[model samples]
Target: MESTSSEYARFLAYGNQLIEVHIGLRDLLADLREGVVPAAELGAHCLAFCAAVTRHHTGEDTQVFPLLAARDPGLRSFLAGLEHDHRIIAGLLTRAGAVAAELRDGSTADGAARLRQELDVVAAVLETHFIGEEKRLVAVLNAIDPSVGLTALTDQAVEFR
Candidate 1:
């Protein structure tokens, strides 16, 4: 049985992948500034990053969040906030994707600067959301045995409630 800490640790590692996207975006921005990374490559990277984010989010929304929310009634408000924050951040990423596509097409359009701006917006929102989520979820970690926690969290998501 994995410990509660172990499962949370796993999820936290997943969270870090989103951070990696932010890092990648910044790197791409640097490339854009230097004309080193082709716009097409950057657009593809952004799309892939977004896809990864969608998967991480699906697991959290469909599996992780439901388990945590059911077990902790006190977290209901915070959970709602988290969901809202996710939508906000996603919007920013969508904008970045648009700008990236434009850039990749070599359109004289103001894509590079717009992409950089949107990326910053999404990154800032995501940072705040992750901080709040960690603060709330950390206490629940280790509150139950690892096996029970993982099973309840991943399998049924409803049993915890």
Candidate 2:
């Protein structure tokens, strides 16, 4: 079995990757707001970000959370709050997705601005969610069922891969 700290270290590493992606996506949003990004680039980035977020949330909802909840009573209760945040973030992305499609089809400057605002909302809400998750659950995650949580995370990541 992997050491508890190692499993948590791996989990935090994944969280850090998402954080990096969000930072990049946030910069892309800022560029869109400033009208600095080429429309083609902006549209492409938005599509990629939407896809990335959907996959990330799917992994959490389907695989990771369930595994964590099995061993930790704490995690099960926290799922409600986490899922709520997920819904909010996903809605922001859905709205942002519409704006991206408009931009791709050659909408006006306001179209891009609208998407940028939506993306900012996603960034803010997701950042808070992610930070809370790390503080409240990341370390304890390793102590949850490693055979379950790690295996599920690995299997789901393969499916996602």
Candidate 3:
């Protein structure tokens, strides 16, 4: 089994990756807001951001949450809440994606305005969800046995697509 310290380090690394991607998405959204990104690329950028978030959530739901549930039944409710947040986030992503697809020519005043609104909703919810998850599970995750590794938690193979 991996030492608790080592596992904690790994969990922190994963958290950092999540932060990095979140910042990247925010930066892209800011560019979109500034009307700098071409309309043709907006959809792709949105898709990438959504994909990353989906992968992270799917990883938690399938790999991390299950383990946490099995290890501590008391966490079931908390995990369920996180899962609910995932669904909400997924819906928000879908909404944003549709808008992005419509922006094929470049951002218009109305489209940009609408997209900003959608992204704001996404960002608000995601910030809450991410913080709640870290508060509730980061320590538990770090204590998991090294034998039953958490590689799956950080894996992107099991997608939400």
Candidate 4:
């Protein structure tokens, strides 16, 4: 019984950490969208945000999702849906990064507007994805075995530049 409780605690921590990472990513995107980061540095900031999000999704796809799917066959379809979101997000990030680069290079007269649009789309999709993930997975994650080392869930902490 105590072992089961410990497992719940450990996996719950993983779920909480996942949400924390998502929040951090959202905040970074908000800063970029709001022009909180200097105009000159917007390109660099956008790239950094893109990288952070990629790392987080990659970690979940490679580590967390596999473990969960293996533990519960029922999660396979749900995990696949999340993976689909990741692919869509990856495309959006690439588009945003290209716009940012064009802006930095002074090659696009409307780069800022285009970037903002891309960011808005990214933000909307991300918000939906995060909410669905948190709602569905927190309870599922809380039931995973504690023996599955927490390191398996680590996504290399999100870094802000």
Candidate 5:
């Protein structure tokens, strides 16, 4: 069977993949907080989450946001806000990663407490950023030329690659 999907659908799928990664990180953090995941694994998990978010945000800033801004000047303010959110999330992720790195064992009371708190903040900020982005940009994305070649953005942001 031949399947045809619009660029908007493809883009949304890509964005959803990033969101799912955030969700997975949230779950992992929750497990860490509950002592379900081994404490020693927390640092590696934090680093992986940080990498995924950096890649996703970099793709958006370099590819998706620039194209959208050029095509629709009215979106400039919204994109700016999103960019600001990205910076904030980046800081939170960095702090979380640092705290995670300090965790010698999941049983480390102070380090685990700090890392869990940092992850909680990251998850909250990410939730807000993702929802706001989808609300503001999904329709615009759908309206963009389907052949505009967003392969770089999608390739980097999507996990299945």
Candidate 6:
């Protein structure tokens, strides 16, 4: 019984770590959207944000999702949906990166506005994705065996800027 309790605690840690990453990403997006980063460095900052998000999704797709699917065959379809969301987010990131490049090159007078628009879309989609993922996966994650090395699931920590 003690072992089961310990495993439950570890599983909850995994969910908490996942939420922490999402919160960090949300904060970074808010910073970008609020113009907290100066124009001179906006391009670099935006690119870094995109990279961090990409890394998070890539880690989930490669490490976390596979493990979850293996643990519960019922989750395969749900995980597929999450993977689809990752692809959508990837496209949004690419668009954001392109706008950031334009801003860096000083090629567009309204580059900031364009970049902001792109980021707005990304934020909306991410909000939906993150909420849905947390709602569905937290319980499942908490039910998994703690001995399964859950640390590897979210080990690719996003560096907060």
By TM-score, who's the top model here?
6
User: Please, what is the TM-score per model?
Assistant: 0.66, 0.71, 0.69, 0.83, 0.72, 0.83
lDDT: which is higher, 3 or 4? 4
Cα lDDT tens digits, model 1, 1-88, are 5556666566555445445544555565455445475655766666665565555555567765776677667777877777777777
**Backbone clashes under 3 angstroms, per model:** 0, 0, 1, 0, 1, 0
Better of 1 and 4 by TM-score: 4
After superposition on all C-alphas, the RMSD of every candidate to the true structure, in Å, is 5.1, 4.3, 5.1, 5.2, 5.2, 5.1
The residue pairs that clash in candidate 4, if any, are none
Query: Candidate order by lDDT, highest to lowest?
Result: 6, 4, 5, 3, 2, 1
State the weakest 10-residue window (summed lDDT) of model 5: 152-161
Flag the better candidate by TM-score, 1 or 2.
2
The list of candidate 5 runs beyond 4 A from truth reads 1-34, 104-109, 145-161
Question: Model 3 scores what on Cα lDDT?
Answer: 0.68
Local distance difference test values of all predictions, in order? 0.60, 0.67, 0.68, 0.81, 0.69, 0.84
RMSD of 2: 4.3
Question: What is the C-alpha lDDT profile of model 2 across 1-161, one tens digit per residue?
Answer: 55545665666565565556556655655665566877566766787778777777777787667756754557677887887888888888888888888877777677666777877787777778877876665556434443444543343332211
Question: Candidate 3 on 1-161: residue-level lDDT in tens?
Answer: 54545655665566555556556656765665566766556666766777777887888788667756765688899899989999999999889877766664455546656776787788778778767776666555545566655444443322221
Q: How many backbone clashes can be found in candidate 1? A: 0
Local error of candidate 1 at 147, Å? Answer: 9.1
* Cα lDDT, model 4, residue 55: 91
Q: For candidate 4, what is the TM-score?
A: 0.83
Off by over 4 Å in 3: 1-40, 105-109, 145-161
Candidate 4 local distance difference test against the native: 0.81
